[model samples]
Target chain A: MTIRIAAVGDIHLSEHARGTYRAHLDGIDERADVLLVAGDLTRHGTVEEGQVVVDEFRDLGIPVVFVLGNHDYHSDAEQEIAAMLRTAGMYALDDSAEVLLDGRLGVAGGKGFGGGFAGKCASEFGEPETKAFVRHTREIADRWRIALKGLDTDHRIVLSHYSPVKETLAGEPPEIYPFLGSYLLAEAADAAGADLIVHGHAHAGTEKGVTPGGIRVRNVALPVLGRAYAIYCLGGEEL
Target chain B: MDIWDPPHYVAARVQRAIAEDERTNELGIRVDIRGDHLFLQGQVCEEDQRERVAQVAAEAAPGMVVHNEVICVAVGEPGEQEVL
Candidate 1:
């Protein structure tokens, strides 16, 4: 049986955008079996905005899994927003993993950080500020590695708000590549094994890419997709 | 001589304002300064958000002609499913 996964990111919903987006989700149940929201569900990350996200996503009949983006941390209320999502019966992952589709599929990841790609990436040396920035990405990658290893399923997927490889961020300015994503994320997923990786946060990025390990990567940022969501079928003949 | 703010600096400031301003927390809006005009370009999800982004850009770079060229993103139905 193929698991149809519908994914999107960077919705940036707020009070002003209350029901405008949900209107587009009509008939989503007919399109996919599950929905994966990469991140950036709210414009300001406020609890109020989080409520908007809940109202927009709740009762969709499909399992809705999400992570918090940098925009969702603006008000230092990321935890509160995540709690709200959990209360609404949604899965909010923070460097964790979840088994869905009756344990046939496993998803691991969180809001991946950025430090550029392999050769051009940042190092944990030099000033404390620079080291901290790179270290944060390193830590998140480590947690993902652990999460992926713990999962025992037929297929595995990684969901994040940041890109894992630069291939998906082609249209974005090269100068900002370091801030868009890091290679550490792809490395962890590659080492632990995954069927696919989904991410966002690069509005101008493209939609498809692959990790060095041959895992497929898709950037479902709403702007990049020009649609409400994208559906990817796993456990097919191609896989 | 009134030394005008550097065009790059003006664009950077406006871009930062669009991302950081409470009224408009849009992170991907592109702000560009050419001569005396500042152009704002990006896809917002709502018409009101487009206006709010433009308003923040104009307030960030007063005295410059601000062009609000940002468009609203179309959230159409779910397209074809890619089998992997």
Candidate 2:
């Protein structure tokens, strides 16, 4: 049985976006078994924007899971946004995991942070601010790892708002790579061995990559996907 | 009298200007200074954001030439394969 997973990120819906996504996201029930939102669901992370997101997905009769992105924290009301999303029946996974399709598919995610990539990345031994920056990414990645490990489903999928591997950030300016995502998330996913990984936040980035452990990574930012969503069939003979 | 390079001053001012503006702050636009020229680059979700960035840069450094290279692409406008 192939569980179709549809994913996209960086919607950045605002007041102006009211009713914009409905036409684009209608009838997803026939196309996907589940929907995964990778983050930036709001332009400024307002509860009103979150309401718009809820309204967009309320009628899409399928399970929806999401992780918040940096933009979702801009207004510092991410908790309110998360709560609203939850009330609308979407799972907001922050350093958490969920089992779907009768426990056959496990999903885990967090709002991954950035501290550069492997070779040229930030370290915890520098300035206090620098340490805090890198430390946050490390902590999120660790939580993701633990969440993935705790899942006992037949197939595992990792979701994140920030890119894990630099491969997906290829088209973005090289100078901003550190801010785009971190290698720590990739390291955690690779360590846990996921069947697939999805993320957003890199608007100009490519759509595909593979972890060091060969787990497939995809950047599903709405801009990158150029679509309402992309569906991936998981846990079949193909895997 | 403290002497600072004009370009550096312009860059610093532009940086603060962008940071102070809510829309531009969310855009995370980067300001680069080369001599008296200011280059702005980042991904903004709206066309107005691009214009606002240039406006902010201009206001920050009145005499500096502003080169606005920010890309304004609406999110989810491309490759929309919704099964409608």
Candidate 3:
């Protein structure tokens, strides 16, 4: 059975965006079985913007899963936005796991964080502030590792707002790579295992990449894809 | 135009304002200053947002000529399906 997974991120919707973005999703049900919104559903991360997200994403007639991006946390309303989306019958993942397609597919994810990649990444050895920054990514990675391990579904995908590997962030300036994503995320998924890792937050990044462990990673940020969404088919006789 | 703030600093300030200003909280826009001209490049979801970014950049650096090169992101249809 092939699971058609439609994904996009960095929608950046707001009150001004009402009735503008949803038109792209017309008849999405026919194209894919599920839609996974990687993150950045709002512009300023305001509660009002959260309502816009709910209105646009709700009643899509398919399982729509979401994770918050940094832009969605700008106003410190990430929890409220997630809660509101949940109340609207959407699945919101925060360093957690959700099984869809009747336990056939499991997605584990959160916003993810940035600390750099591999040897170029940050470390815990430093001042309290520096340590905290790197530690934040480490802790999120730990939770994801645990989440991926607990998922018993046939297919597991990790959704995040930050890039897990440098390959997907090719267009972004090399200087800002640390702020874009960290290798720790890829390490976690590699340790626990997953079919794919989907992320955003890299507006200029490319659409496809693979982790050092050979797991596929794709950046579905709207600007990167230049499309409303990208569909990836998993677990079929073709495979 | 202050002697203490160089063109680089002006670019940085405009970039920061574009990201931090409530009127235009766009993170992906890049600001560059060449001579007396300030160039703004990147993509926004809407045309109005692009104008607002230029407005914010102009306000940040009063004397420079603001060139808004940012384009509206055209989100087309879901193209093809990639089988994994």
- Model 2 chain A: ten consecutive residues of lowest lDDT: A230-239
Over A14-63, each residue of candidate 1 has an lDDT whose tens digit, in order, gives 88878767788888888888899999998888989999999999999889
Off by over 4 Å in 1: A237-239
Docking quality class, candidate 1: medium
Please say which candidate is ahead in TM-score: 1 or 2: 1
Q: In model 2, which regions exceed 4 Å deviation?
A: A237-239, B1-16, B28-42, B63-71, B74-84
lDDT of 2 by residue, A96-153 (tens): 9999989988999979999898898889996899899999999999999999999999
User: What is each candidate's DockQ, to 2 decimals?
Assistant: 0.77, 0.24, 0.80
Enumerate residue pairs that collide in model 2.
A226-B78, A226-B79
> Which parts of model 3 are misplaced by more than 4 Å?
A237-239, B1-4
Docking level of model 3: high
Which of candidates 1 and 2 is the stronger one according to lDDT? Answer: 1
* Residue-level error in angstroms, candidate 2, position A202: 1.6
Worst 10 residues of 1 chain B by lDDT: B72-81
Tens digits of per-residue lDDT for model 1, B16-40? 9998899988877888788998888
